[model samples]
Target: MRQKATSLFAVLLLLAAGVAPVGAVVGTGVEASAVQSNCSFPVTATDATGTEVTVEQKPENVVTLGPSEAQTMWEIGGKSQVVGLTKYASYLDGSDSRTNVSGAGRSYVNVEKVVAEDPGIVLAANIVSNETVQKLRDAGLTVYKFEKAKSLEDIYAKTTLVGELTGNCEGASETLSWMKDRISTVRSAVEGSDAPRVFVSQGAGWTAGENTFINRMVELAGGNNVAVEANVSGYGKISEEVIVAQNPEWIVQLGAFGAYPKTDAYNGTDAVKNGRVMTVSNQNVSQPAPRVVYAIVKMAEAFHPDAFAAANATTTASETTTTQPTESTTESAPETTTEGAMEGDSTETTTDAEDSTGGTPGFGVPVALAALAGAAMLARRR
Candidate 1:
C-alpha cells in the first residue's frame, strides 16, 4: 500500500508539475502535538486509511487522502475546508492555499511538511500507513480512517459521512438521495424489460465486472454487463469466444480507454459490426464526481437509442420554442486539445486527467499508464 501510494504521488507530481521522479522515501516522525476543543461529530472515528483519527473539533484544515474522496467533500459544499491532498486533490478552487505534503528520507513532504500544513484532520484512503497515522495522531492531529467505498451503497454512505465530517450533512443527504432516486427511476424504466447485453471497458484492456460501481451504473442504464456474465472479480480477461458467443449490443470504454476499438475487434465482431461502440468522459461516469448522475442520463440515451433520440427531439423542440438567451460565459468555442480521439490514449477533454500523457494502452496490454488522466482512484472497499 505504501509503495502504491508513493507511486501514485510520484506519477501525479511528475506529470502535473513536469518534475522528474524524486527519490524520497516515505518517513515517520511524531512532532510536538496539541489538541484543541471545537469538536462536533463524534469524538473519534476510523478513516478509509484504517487510522483511528480523532477530532477535538470540526476540522478547519483537512487533507483528503482517498481516490475521489475529495469529490465527496466537494459535493457537500465543503471545498473550502480541504487544506491538502495526497495528489490530484487540487480540483477545488481555493485548494491552492492547502499544503502538498510528501514523505521523509526523501525530498517529498516529510513529517515536517505535514506538521507544517497544520491540518486538524486528515481524510485518508484505505491504504495509508498506520505508523504515519500514529505519528500524526501522537502529534495531536485527529486522524480519521475513512473506510473504502466499493459499491453503490458505499458511495451513499461515503457521501453522507463526508457531509457529516465537513459540516455539510444536509448537502450529502440531498445529493445521495437524488442519486438514489435517479438510479431507481432508471432501473424502473428498464426493469424486467429484457436487459440489453452491454460491454464496458475501463483502464487498459479491462472490462467492468460486478465488483465495480460502473457495473451498477450499467444495470441502471438498462444494459447488462458482459464482463459480469462471467462473474469474475476486479478486472479480468474476456476471451474472444465469449464476445462472439454473447454478442453484446453496446461497447463502452470508460476512464482513459473511453474509445473501444470496434474496428480492432476480432474479425469485425458484433460490437464492431453493429456500430454500438461509443467513447465518453470518465469523470461523468466512472469517477464518483458531481457528474455521475448526468452519466446515467447520457448512458440511458445510448442504450435506448430511438427513445432517447425522440426524447432529445422533444427537448430540442421545447428549447427552440421558448429559448431565451442568457449571457453565456462560454461565448467562444472551447479550443480543441486533442487532434484525434484515440480509443485508449486520447486526453481530449480538460478534466482531471489532462497531463498524464504517455503510451497508448488497450486490450490485452497491461495498464501501463492511464495516458490522459492523473486522478487517483484508490478505493477503500472495506
Candidate 2:
C-alpha cells in the first residue's frame, strides 16, 4: 500500500506538470493566467505548481497570503500593490512590505482588513479555507488562489504573472529570460562534477520535509539533501543519531533575518567542528523575492566552494550588522499598510517613493473614489 501510494503521488506530480506547464495557461481564463508565451514558441518558464491565479486587467490593490508570494510580488516591482502581508514576510529584508493587517500566521488576516484595503484583487495561498475564499468573494473582492510556489520554475511563472497583472509583462519576460539563461549557465557549471554534500536545516526547526521548495533548491544548487529520508510527508527533522551517522560535509542554516549564528547553535555536530556550515538569509535563499537567482548562486557557492570562491565579496558578519532592519521594519509594520487600518494602527499617512523610472506613480481608481467620497461629504455639509 505504501508503494502504491508513493506511485500515485509521483503520478499526480507529473500530471500536474503536464497540464500546468511553465509557460502558458491551459483551459483556464486566458487573461487571468499568470504566465503567457514570451512572443515566441519554445519558451522556457517557471512551471507553476498548481497555483490557480486569475489576475483581472491590472490590479491596483493586491494582497498576498504567503511569505513567498509576498516577497515575489515585491521583487517583481509590485510592492505598491501589496496592502497585506503575513508576519513572517516581515522577518526577511523588505519582506514586510505591508503593515500588520493580518496576523503572523493564518490568524492575522481578517475580512474587515481585506475590505479596508479595498483591493481589486487578492493573491492568496492555496491552503486557505473554503470559507475564507467565499468570504472574500462575498465582499466583492477577486481572489487569485495560488499554491505555494516551490521551484525555480514556480518563481519565474509567479514573477511573470505579477508583471502581467501590473502592466509590466515586458519587464517580467525580460527578467525571466535573463534568469533562465543564468540557470542554464549555473547548471552547466555543476554538470559532471561532484557537488558538496549539503544539509539544510530550517533555523527554527529540524530539516525540511519532502517536496519542499528547499528540496528543489538542493537539486538546483547541485547538493544532496539529507532530509529525503523522511516519510511520504517529504520533510521531517531527523534524529541527532541519524544526522551524526550521515555526517554531512556541509550544513546550511535557513533564517529570515540573514543567517543566524550557528557556532554555538550546532555545537556537538560535525558541521560545527569542521566549519562546513553556513548561515544564509531565508529572504535571499527561500522567499520569492527578485534576488532568488542570486540566492541560487550563493547556494552554489556553498555546495561547490571551489567554483564560486570569488562570490564571497561581502562577509556574513558585515551583512548581518549593516543590513539589520529591525527598527525600520518594526516601525513600518504597524502603520504603513492597509493592514494598519485593520490592526487599528492606521493614523498618519505618507506618500510612497516616486517611480524610479521618473513617471507618475499609479495609485489605481480607488484613490479617485476616495477623493469623490471626501468631496461628496464636504458638499453635503456646505
Candidate 3:
C-alpha cells in the first residue's frame, strides 16, 4: 500500500508539472477591433510574437498548433477550413479527418506535415515555441501566434481576432455575443452573494495563481481563490500548510487526473470534511476559447447555487415570454449527486467511497495507480 501511494504521489507530481504550461492562457492586451473590418482581405495585425502578419484572402486551408487554437477555429465556424491540427485536438469532432501535425509531443509541431498541408494560414497557440513559428515562416507559410490569454476580455479579443483572420467574422461575433450574455447572467446571479473561498487543484500540490485563466474563472464565478490569497503568483506548487490554513470552502479539480494529495493537511480541510469538491473538464477550463464560459457557468452554479438558480429561472421565464424556447436557449442547473458533487460531461464529482487506508475517501491505492499510469501517458503526450 505504501509503495502504491508513493508511486501515485510521484505521478501526481509529474502531472502537476506537465499540466500548467500546456494550453496555459494569459493576456495579450490586443483588442478585438484591432483589425479595421470583418472579413477584410489583406488585413495586417501584429501577433503575440510581435510580427506583423497579413492575411491576403480567406484561408481555404488552416492549421492549428495547439488544442485551444483548434477549438477556437471550430467554435467560430471554421472547422472545415482546418486541414491540420495536433494530436491533442483529437477530442474535436471530425479531427481524425485532418492531418496530424504533432511532432514528438503535444507542444512540438511537425513542420514537414504542416508544410505538406499547404495551409493558407497557421494559427499558433501560446504553447508553440517561437522557433517553431519561425520555422513555419521560413518554409514560406503565414503563421499568426497568439499570446497567453489572461482574462475573459483577452479571450474575447482572441476569438474576434481568430474570426477576422479566418474570414469567419460573423461567426466570431455571434460566439462573442453568446459568451458575453452567459457571463453577464452568471455575474448577475452571483451578485450580492457571499463569495466562497475556492482552492483549485490542477493535481498534486499545483494550483493556479494570479495572471492565469483559472484564477480569473474563480473570481468571475464569485469565489475568492485561496492560491491568490496566499500570494502564489503563477502556476506553482502550494504548501499543504497553506491549504489547511486557508481552509477553502470549495476545492475544484481541473480534470479527471486531478486529485487531492493523500495527506492529513488536505484531509483536514473544510472542503473535504463537507464534501464540497467538484471537477471541471480540462478542455473547457484549460483552453482559452469560447467554451470556457461553460466552465464559468458550472463554477458559478457550484459556488452560488441559490443565486444561480434564481437567475436561471428568471432568464428562462423571460425567454419563454419573449419568444418560443429553443433547445439552445433552454438551460438547467447542474445535477448534484453528492452534497458538493455535480454531474455532467463538463462538470462532475468523484463518487464517494470509504477509505480503508485512512486517506481521502474515493481515492484509494488502486485508483491512484490507475490514475498514475494514465497521467504518465498523458504527460508524455503533452
Among the numbered candidates, top lDDT falls to: 3
Report the candidate with higher TM-score, 2 versus 3: 3
Q: Evaluate model 2: give its lDDT.
A: 0.47
Q: Write the per-residue lDDT of candidate 2 for residues 1-382, one digit (tens) a residue.
A: 5544333322221111110111232223333224454322222222122334445457667777545556556555567777776554564456454655553211435667877888867765433444555678789877765433435665676666656655556556555655665566567556666866567664323455456556666668777776664341343445655666566677776532112234443465666688776665444553443555665666676676664443333232223221112112121221122211111111011111111111111111222233233333334554
Q: Residue by residue across 1-382, what tens digits does model 3's lDDT show? A: 5544444444432232222222212233346544334577876778756788989999999998766788788887899999998656666778889998876412346799999999999997654566667889999999987765556777788888888888998778767766776787899988989999999876667677876657878899999999999998766778988988999999988665557676899888888899999887766675667777888898999899889988887675333121111112121111110101100011101211111011121122333344466555555564
* Local distance difference test, each candidate: 0.48, 0.47, 0.66
For model 2, the stretches where C-alpha displacement exceeds 4 angstroms are 1-56, 91-99, 103-106, 203-205, 229-233, 256-270, 285-291, 309-382
Deviation from truth (RMSD, Å), model 3: 10.8
The model with the greater TM-score, 1 or 2, is 1
Q: Could you tell me the TM-score of candidate 3?
A: 0.75
- lDDT (C-alpha) at residue 287 in model 3: 63
Off by over 4 Å in 3: 1-30, 33-38, 105-107, 316-382
Off by over 4 Å in 1: 1-43, 46-53, 91-97, 102-110, 230-232, 262-267, 284-292, 305-382
Better of 1 and 2 by lDDT: 1
